[model samples]
Target chain A: MKPIIEISGISKRFRISHELQPYLNIRDRVSQIFSGKKATSTEEFWALKDITFSVEAGESIGIIGKNGAGKSTLLKILSKITPPSSGKIISRGRIASLLEVGTGFHPELTGRENIFLNGSILGMRKNEIQGKFDEIVDFSGVEKFLDTPLKHYSSGMQLRLAFAVAAFLEPEILIIDEVLAVGDAEFQKKCMGKMDEVSKSGRTILFVSHNMGAVSNLCSKAVLLRDGKIAMIDNSSKVVEQYLHDSVQMSGKRRKTISALDKSFTLQLPYWVNNAGEEIPSYSFGSDYKLRFDFEFHRELTFLNIGIAVMNKDGSRIFTSHSVDDKSFQSFSTYNGKMTFDAHLNIPDLAPGYYQVLFGVADEHTHDYVNASSEVEVILDIAETHKIKDGANGILWHTGQWKKVG
Target chain B: MEYEIKPAGRFSLNLSELWEYRELIFFFTWRDIKVKYKQTFFGAAWAVIQPLLLMVVFTVFFARNFTIESGNIPYPVFVFSGLLLWNVFANGLSNAGNSMVANANIIKKIYFPRLIIPISSILSAMVDFLISIIVYFCVLFFYGLQSTIPSILLMLPLSLLITLCTTLGAGSFLAALNVKYRDFRYVIPFLIQVLMFMTPIIYPVSTPDMEWVRTLLLLNPMTGAIDLIRSAVMQVPVNQTAVAMASVSSLLWLIIGISYFRRTEYYFADLA
Candidate 1:
C-alpha cells in the first residue's frame, strides 16, 4: 500500500528582524524611502529543516516535541496554511487542518448561521454540512440556543460548537495541532473518542500535542523532533519513553546550575538512595525509596521548615509531604553556624516512569526563606515492578488490603 | 484528490482554487450582510436612507445653488441615480480595502483563497446597492421620468457590471496594500472621498466647461459607471468615449489589483 502523505526535505526559514515593531507603519516606511536608508538587519531562523516523513493509509502518527521544536511549523506546512521555504509535500487525499477551532466564526451571526459559515471555512461542502447539521448540534449540545447570536453564547459553548464542526469534517487526512488544549475535561474526552473512531475508520491522522500519555495511547507510531530535526521515529510508547528520559537528563543539568549559584547555604541535589547509602537511578514500582537532601546552613536559623512534593511528567503534583506535618521533625528548626542537615524522605507506592521531586524550604516566623522562596526539581525514575496486568492507571500503585467481613 | 504543494510563483492566478472555495465566499458575504444590519434600528432601510439623505443634501446644496443643466431630467432624480451607483463603488471599495485586516483572525488560522475575503466584501456591498436602486426608482417615478423597459434592463446591468469590476479591481488592490503598508487604511477613506467628487456624482460632468476638468473627471474609472447609470435612468444619451474609457480603466485596475493581490496573498497569514 502506498503512503497517503509524502513529505521530503521540508524546511521553513523565517526572516526575523530585531526591529522596534513587528510591523512597520506608514510613517517609518515613508521616512526610510525619503531618507534612502536601508532596512535594519535581519536574521534568518530555520523553524524546520530537512524534515522527511511519510504516513501510510489508516495510520495515526504523533509528532512530539518541546516548545519551539518546529512541530507546529511542520504541521502548518502539511496543512498548507504556510508554504515551506524549500521542499515539497505530495498528499494523496484531501487534508483538513484543525490548528484552531472556530476559524471564521462571526460573533454577530446566529449559531445556525455560524455553523454553516464555520463549516465552509473548514473546507466542508454546503451539502455535507447540511447533512451533518443535526449531528453537529447534537454533538455540541447547543440545540436550544441555535437561533441565538454567537456573541451571546459563552466562550465554552462557542468552543464546543467550533469543535463539533471540525469533528465532523470527513477529510481523508486530518492534521490536528494541540486543539485539544482547551475545553473541559469531559469535552476533551469526547473529542479523543471521536478522533479514535475516525482513526479506526481507516483515515490518516497527524497529531501534534504536548500530552505524552494521549500521544502514546492514540498513535501507533511517533516522531520525536529536536532542534528542527527528527530525533527519533519509533513505536509511540518507546519514543515517549526516550523523550521522557532525555528530558530528565536536561532537567538534571539545570538542577545543578541552580544549586551551584546559591552562596548563603548549600542544598545538594536530591536523589534516590537505597538503605546502604548508595545512590540509585531508578526505584521499583510499589516499593519504598529513600530521598536524601543534604543542605549546609551558613548562619543560625529558626523555625526552618522543609517540604517535598512529587509531580508527574505533566507537572501536576501527585502528593506533598512537609516536615511540619510530622511532630518529631518539627523541632529541628534552629541551625548553628555552618551546620549541615540531611533530610531523609521515605516515599512509597509510586508508579513507573519519570517524576519531578520538588524540595522547598520556608521560615515559619520571619517568613524569610531562601531569598524569599526556593523549589528545586529532581527527576525520579520508577521502573515497573507491578505483578498486576496492565500495571496501573494513576501515579500511585498501592495494593490495598482486602478482607472479608463476617 | 492528489496534489503537490511547493513554492508558488509570484504571479500565479489559481482560479480553480478560488472556484473550489466559492461556498466560503457566499458564507462570508452572507455573514457580512447579516452582521451589518444585525442590531440596527432601521435594518436594511439604512441602505435606502443613506443615499436618500445624501441626495437631499446634494439637491439643497448643489442643485439649487448651481444652474447645472442635467438634460431634461430633474436635478434630484439625476443626482439620485448617480448616488445609487456611487454608493456601491465607494462602500464596496472601503469594505474590500479593509477586508484583509478585518479577517486577520481567519487568515492566520486556516488556508483558503484569500481573494474570497475581498470579493465577498464587494458582494455584500452589492446587497446595499440593490436596496438603494429600488429607492432610486421610487425617486425617478416621483419626478415623472419614464425610462424604456428595454433600456433600463440593458443599461442597468451593463452599468452595474462596470461598477462591480471597478470596485473589485480597486478594492482587492487596496486590501493587499493595506495588509502590507497599513497606510492605505487611512488613505482609502480619503481616496474614496476624492473619488466621489471626481466621479461627478453631485454635479453633471458637463458643468465643468473647461476641457481639462471634464477630461480629468472622465479619467476616473468610476466616472463612466456613475454616468452610465445616470443616463440610463434619465433617458439621456450616453457618452461613448467616457464609457469606453471606463471599460479600459476598470480592466487595467482589475489586472493590476488581482495580480498584486495574488503575488502577496501567500504572505498575508504571516504579515496580516
Candidate 2:
C-alpha cells in the first residue's frame, strides 16, 4: 500500500525575543513607520531544528520528550494545528486530535450539545455523529448527566465526554497530545483500547504523551524527542526503553534551584532509580507499593521535616505525607553524604490512577523549605471492577472503622 | 495504506472535499452560537436583541434628533434597514477576524482546511441575521413601508456580496495582524466601534447636496450596502451609477482581501 502520509526533511524554527518586544501603540507605530529606524532587536529560538520521519497507515506512533523538546510542536505540525517553517510536510488523509481535552466545548452547553459540537470539530458529519451519538455517550458514561451544563460536571467528566466525542469520530488519521492524562485509569484504558482499535482499523495515529508505559503498550512505533529534534524513533519498546533511560538520566543531572515565595532550596531531579536500578514504575490510584528517595545537602542541615506530595496525572496534590517530629536522618557534617527517605504507605481511595510524587525537604526551625528528589512515575493497573469512586479524584482511604456505640 | 503526517504543509483545500466537510462547518457554526449565548439568560433571542436595540438607539439619536437623510423614507425604517445590512456585515467581519486565533487548539492538533474556520464563523452569523431580519420586517410594517420584490431581489444578493468583500478584506487584514502583533485583538473591537458609527447604520448617507460627505463615506464598502438596503425598503429608485461603482469597489476589495489572506494563511497556524 502507498504510504498515506510522507514527511521528509522537515525543519521548524521559532523566533524568540530576548525580551518582550512591545508592539508599538498606534501613535508609536505611526512615528516609527515615518522615521524608518529599527525599533527593536529580535532573537530566534529553533523550536524544531531539523525533523525527519514518516509513519504508515494503521500505525500508532507515540512521541515522547521532555518539556519544550518539541514533542507537542511536532504533533501540532503533523496535525496541521500550525504550519512548519522552512520545511515540507506532505499528508494525504483526514486527521483529528484531542490537543486539549474539552477545547471546543462550551461550558454553558450540555454534554449532548458538546458531543455534537466536538464531533463536528473533528470533521464528522452531523448525521454521522448522530448515528454514533449513543455509542459515544455510552462509552463516556455521561448519558445520565447528558443534559446538564458541562460546567457542573467535574473536570474529569468533561474530559471523558470530550475524548469520547473525538475518539468515536471516524477520521483517516488521528493525533492526540497528553490529553489522555485526564480522567481515571479505566477511562484511559478504554481510550487506549479505542485508539488501538482505530490503529488496527488502518488509520494513522500520532500520539504525544509523557506516559512511557502507555506508549509501549498502545503504539506500534515511537519517536523520542530531545532539544527539538528526533533523538530516537524505533519500535515502541526501544523508544520507551531509551525514554526511560533519559528520564533516569535527568534525575542525575543534579541542578539547584530555590523555590520561589520562600527561602527553600529545591533540588531538581535529573534522573531517578529504584534500588534495583529499574526506573520507577508508572503509578495509578491506590497502588500497593513503597518508594524511596535519596538526596545530599551542602550546608550542615538539621531539624528538617520532609513531605512528599504525590501529584496525579493532572498535577493535583493527590496526597502528602511527612516524617515524624523527632525524625532524624543519618546526619552528616560533610558535603558528600546521602539521606535516604522511605515512604511505605498503601495508596488508598485513589481513582484508578497514574502519579508522579514530588519530595520536599524543609527546615523545621525557620520553616525554610526545599524541593528535593522525586520518584519517577509509577503506574498501578487495577482492574475495572474496582470502580468505586464516581468521577472524583478519590485520594483519601479512611482506615477508621465505626463502632456501634449506641 | 501508510500515512506519516509530520509537518502540516501538504494540506490542500479541494472545494469538493470541503463539501464533504460541510457537517464540520455546521458544527463549528453551532459551537459559535452556543458559546455566544451559553451564559446569557436571553438565549437565542439575544441575537435579535443586539441589532434591534441598536436600531432603537440609532432611531432616537440620529434619525429622530438629527436630520440624516434616507431617500424618500421615514428615518426609523431607513436606519433599521441600514442596521440590517451593516449588522450582518460587521458580525461576519468580526468572526473572520478572530476565527483563526480562536481555533488555535484544533488547528494545532489536526489537519483540515484552514479556511474553514473563518468561513464557518461567517456562516454562523447568517443565523443571527435571519433572526434579526424577522424583527426588521415587524418594524417595517409598523412604519407602513413595503419592499418591492425587485428591490429586495437586487438588494439581498448585493448586500451579501458587499459583506463578503468587506469581511474578507478587513478580517484577513486583522487575522494577519493578530499573528505578529496580538494587540490587534484589542484593536479590532475598537476599530469596529468607530466603524459602526461611520457606516450609515445609524444615519443614512448624507444627501446629495452634501456630496463631499457622501463621497468620503462611500469609501467604506458598507456604505454601498446601506444604500442598497435603503432602496430595498423605501422602493426608492437607486442611483444605478453609485450602486454600480460600489459593486465594482466591493469586488476589488474582495480580490485584494482574498489574495492577502491566502498569502498570509500559511503563517497563521504557526503564530496563532
Candidate 3:
C-alpha cells in the first residue's frame, strides 16, 4: 500500500534579525529606503534540516521532541500553514490540523454560533455541523450556556466547546499538536480517548506531544527529534525508552558534593533510596522511601532547616517535608563534625506517574539559604503494582479504608 | 509522487482552488457581519447613521459654503448618492486591507485561499453599503425628486460591481503589502482621505473649470462609477468620455490588484 503522506528532505530556514527592535516605524523605513541603507545584520537559522518521513494509511505516528526541536514547525509544514524552504511533500486525501483549540472563536458570538463558526473554520461543512450539533454540545457539556455569548463562559468551558467542534472533524489525515495540554485531567482523558477512536477508525494520524504515556498508548510508532534532525524512529515504547534514557544521561550523575557554598557547611547525598538503603530510579506505589543527605558542619550553627519538596512532572509542588517539623529533631543541634540525616517518607498511594525531589538547606534564624551549585534533583517514577485497582483518581490516595456504609 | 511548492509565479491566480473553497468564503463573510454588530447597542443602525450623518455634514459645510453643483437635483440627494458609493469603496478598501493581519491567528494555523479574507471583508462592507443605500433613497423621497426608478435599478447594481472590482483591486494590493511593509497600515487611511477629495464625493466631476483638472479627476476610477450612478439615479447629464475612461481605469486597477495579491499571497503566512 502507498503511503498517505510523504515528506522528502524538507528543510526550513528563518532569518533572525539581531537589531535592537522587533520592528521599525514607517518613518524609519521610509528614510532608510531613501537613504539606501540596507538592514544592519541578520543570521540564518535552520529550524528543520533534511527531515524526511512517510506515513501509511491508518498509521498513527507520534512526533516526540524537546522544545524548539522543530516538531511544531514540521506539523506546520505538513498542514501547509507555511511553505518549506526546500524539498517537497505529497499528501493524499483531505487533511485537517488542530494546531490550537480555538483558532478563530469570537468572544462576542454565542456558544451556538461559535460552534458553527469554529466548525467551519476547521473545514467542516454547514450541514455536517448541523447534523452533529447535538452530539457536539453533549460532548462539551455546555448545554446551559449554549445560547450565552462566549465571553461569559469560563475558559475551561470555552476550551471544551472548541475541542468539541474540532472533535467532529472527519478528515482522512489529522495533524495535531500539543492542544491536549489544556483543561483538567478528565478532559485530557476524553481527548485522548477521542484520539484513540480516530486512530482506530483506520485514518492516518500525526500526533505531537510531550506526554510519553499518551503517546505510547495511542501511537503505534514514534519519531524522536533532537537538534532539528530525526534522532530515532521505532515502536512507541522503544522510542520512549530511548528518549528517556537520553534525557537521564543529559541530566548528568545523580550524586554530587556541594563545596561551593559557605565552606562552613558541606552537603552530600546519594539522591533517592528505598527502605533497604539501595539507590532506586523507580518504586512501586505505597512503598516506604528515604532521601539521604550527609551534612558536615565546620562550625556550630544556631538553627538550620533542611527541607525536601516533592513535585510532579509539571513542576507543581505536591508536598514539602522539613526536619524542623519532626518533634524529636526540632531541638537537635549538629556539632563541628559530619553527620548523616534522612527524611523518611511513605510514598503516598499515587496514581502511576513521575515525580521529582528538590532538596534545600536554609538558616532558620537569618532566613538565608545556601546557594549551592550542585543542587540535587532526583526523579522518582511510581509504577502501579498488582495491589491497586483501576478506579483511582488524583495524585494521592488516602490511607483510610472504604466501607459500604449505605 | 512529489508535490512541490516554490515561490509562486506572478500569474498563479489559482481561481479554481478559490472556487472550491466558496463555502468558506461565505462563512468568513457571515462571521464578519455577525461580529461587526454583535456587541454594539445600535447594531446595524450604525450602518445607515454613518453615511447619513456624513451627508448632512457635507451638505451643510460644502454645499452651502462652496455652492456645489447638484445637476438639477437637491444638494442633499446629490451628495448622498455620491456618499453611498464612496462609503462602499472606502469601507471595503480599509476592511479588506486589514483583514489579513487581523486574521493572522487563523492564517498561521490553517491553509485556505488567502484571497478569501480580503473578499469576505469586501462582502461584509457591501452589507453596510446596501443598508445605507436605503437611506439615500429616502433622502431622494424627502426631496420630492422624481427618480428614474428603472434606470436607477439597472445602474445601481452595475455601479456596485465597478466599485467592488476597484476595491478588490486596490484593497488586495494594500492587504498583501501591509503584511510585509506594515507602513501601508498608516498609508491606507491617509490615502482614503485624499481619495475622497479626488473622487468628487462632495463636488461634481465638472465643478473644476480647467479642462486639465476635469481630466485629472476623471483619471480616478471612482469618478466614472459615481458619474454613472448619478446619471442613472438622478437623471444627471453624462460625460461619456469621463465615464469610459473611469470604466477602463477601474478594470485596470482590478487586474493590477489581483495580480499583485496573487504574487505575494504565498509569503503572507510567513510574514504575518
Candidate lDDT scores, in order, read: 0.82, 0.69, 0.81
The DockQ of each candidate is: 0.66, 0.39, 0.41
> lDDT tens digits, residues B1-272, model 2?
23443433443435775677777777788778767876778889988888878777877876667667666777767777877777777788788788878877666555566667877788888888888778877777687664454566567887777777777666766766676687888888788889887776766566545877778678777787777777777766776666776777778776676666666666666666
Better of 1 and 2 by lDDT: 1
At residue A73, candidate 1 shows an lDDT of: 84
Worst 10 residues of 2 chain A by lDDT: A371-380
Give a tens-digit lDDT track for model 2, residues A120-164.
776777788889999998888888999999889987788888888
Winner by TM-score between candidate 3 and candidate 1 = 1
Interface RMSD of 2: 3.8
Q: Which 10 residues in a row give candidate 1 chain A its minimum summed lDDT?
A: A366-375
lDDT score, candidate 1 = 0.82
Candidate 1: tens digits of C-alpha lDDT, residues B90-160: 99999999999999988888888899999999999999888876787778677766554357667877778
Candidate 3: regions farther than 4 A off: A20-39, A252-406, B1-11
lDDT per residue for candidate 1 within A1-406, as digits (tens), equals 6789999999889998776566788998899899997567789999999999899999999998766789988988888778888999999999999988998888889899999999999999999999999999999999999999999999889999999999999999999988886676599889989999999999999999866657877899999999899999998988877877776666434444223233546666666777677666777665566776666666666666677777675546688887778777647656655443444555666667887566666767523244211233466788766467664567677667879998
lDDT of 1 at B265: 87
Best-fitting candidate, scored by TM-score: 1
Best by DockQ: 1
Name the regions of candidate 2 deviating beyond 4 angstroms: A20-40, A254-406, B1-14, B47-52, B68-71, B147-150, B202-212
